[model samples]
Target: MLEIRQIPVLEDNYVYLVHEPVEKLTAVVDPAVTDEVMSAAASAGWTITHILNTHHHFDHVGGNEEIRDKTGCTIVGPRADRDRIPGIEIELGDGDLFQFGAATARVFDVPGHTKGHIAYWFEADKALFCGDTLFALGCGRMFEGTPGQFWPSLKKLRDLPDETRVFCAHEYTQANARFALSIDPDNVELTMRSKEIDALRAHGIPTVPSVLAAEKATNPFLRADQPEIAAQLGMEGRDPIDIFAEIRHRKDNF
Candidate 1:
């Protein structure tokens, strides 16, 4: 079994420690800083052996060199952005399987927020480490990818099993929930979820590690193809991608 720990750092960013016990192998996913990641690993009695980065964003790969130098961990990242990834030793692309001990992650080149962004899906563990691609109730703003490239990227993730646990790298759920409720105000599920999220945040609890099933039902970005969502935006009968773009534009300004 892979033991996962969530380490909150740098404003709203989340750094994850994924440990495979039998081999005593642990991988840090998207470490924005080194101290928090190292501290978390020490607390769990695990040594960091690998650093898995999803993109070249400074916040995502800022600690790559520090962590690698400190632990001598191999750094793995998107093959498409090799030039940008610091200390990248293993370049992974779509359909590649990255093995960490007995746990293997199937890589998906899920770009849109960035041209070379990727997500890691560990099928056996039912866990997805998607950095800035998909979020609890929103998605990362399209900076380096076109709508054409972004929507399909989202679809790939939306098609995952409903039970998959989504470990996106931020704590933007509450704010994203507000935006979701604005356009999807009539959605009962979203309304209920917003309230639940409000309660969770009220107590200083993290709302991440959201289930794919819950996200599919409530995340407006994932439901951009649904007829009701299109209708709500007054773009009835438009192409799903067009509707998706409009929704994304609205959220960008929201």
Candidate 2:
């Protein structure tokens, strides 16, 4: 079985430590801080064998070399981002398969937040390390890619089983939920979820790895096609993609 833990770093970044005790192996995703990664590995009593970078963003790969220099772990990153990523010994691409323990991860090319951004899908375990592509109640801002690229990229994850556990890199659930509610205040799922997320934030708890089912039901970006969202946003009968773009634009200012 896979043991997963979230190591909070910086203000809102979440570095994931995934381990399989039976194999005594560990892998970390998006290490923003070396000390946090080291502490998590020590807590789990597993030697980290690999550091996975979803993109070349500094907040995601800032500690790559430091961690690798300290632990001698292999750095794996998107093959397309060789110039930007640090210490990448293994260059990965879409369709790449990597072993975590007894389980496997399939690489997904999810560009939008970054041109070379990728997500790791552990199908058997139903876990995803999606960087900034998909969030709990929102999607990442388009930084280096087009919305055309982003919508399809998100659709790829949306196509996954509803039970898949989505591990994103930030703690923006409460704000995202509020933005979602603006698009559909009558959505009971979003209404209830917003309160739950507020409580989680107040208690200093993590609001990540939300179930795909919950996101599908309440996330406005994922529900752009729903009549409730379109009507509430004064965009009745609009194309879903346009509605999605408008919502993202509004959130950028919000």
Query: Worst lDDT window (10 residues) for model 2?
Result: 145-154
All candidates: CA RMSD in angstroms? Answer: 0.6, 1.3
* Model 2 Cα lDDT, one tens digit per residue, 1-254: 78899998898999999887777778889998898789889987888888999999899999999999888999998987877899998888888998766889999899888999999999988999999999999999989987777888888889889999999999999989888877778888789999999999999988898999999999888877789888888999988778878888999998
Clashing residue pair totals per candidate (backbone < 3 A): 0, 0
Q: Scored by Cα lDDT, where does model 2 land? A: 0.89
User: How many clashes (backbone atoms < 3 Å, residues ≥3 apart in a chain or on different chains) does model 1 have?
Assistant: 0
Candidate 1 lDDT score at position 232 = 93
Give lDDT tens digits, candidate 1, residues 1-254: 89999999999999999999989999999989999899999999999999999999999999999999999999999999999999999999999999888889999999899999999999999999999999999999999998889999999999999999999999999999999999899999999999999999999999999999999999988987899998899988898889889989999998
* Best candidate according to TM-score: 1
**Each candidate's lDDT (Cα)?**
0.95, 0.89
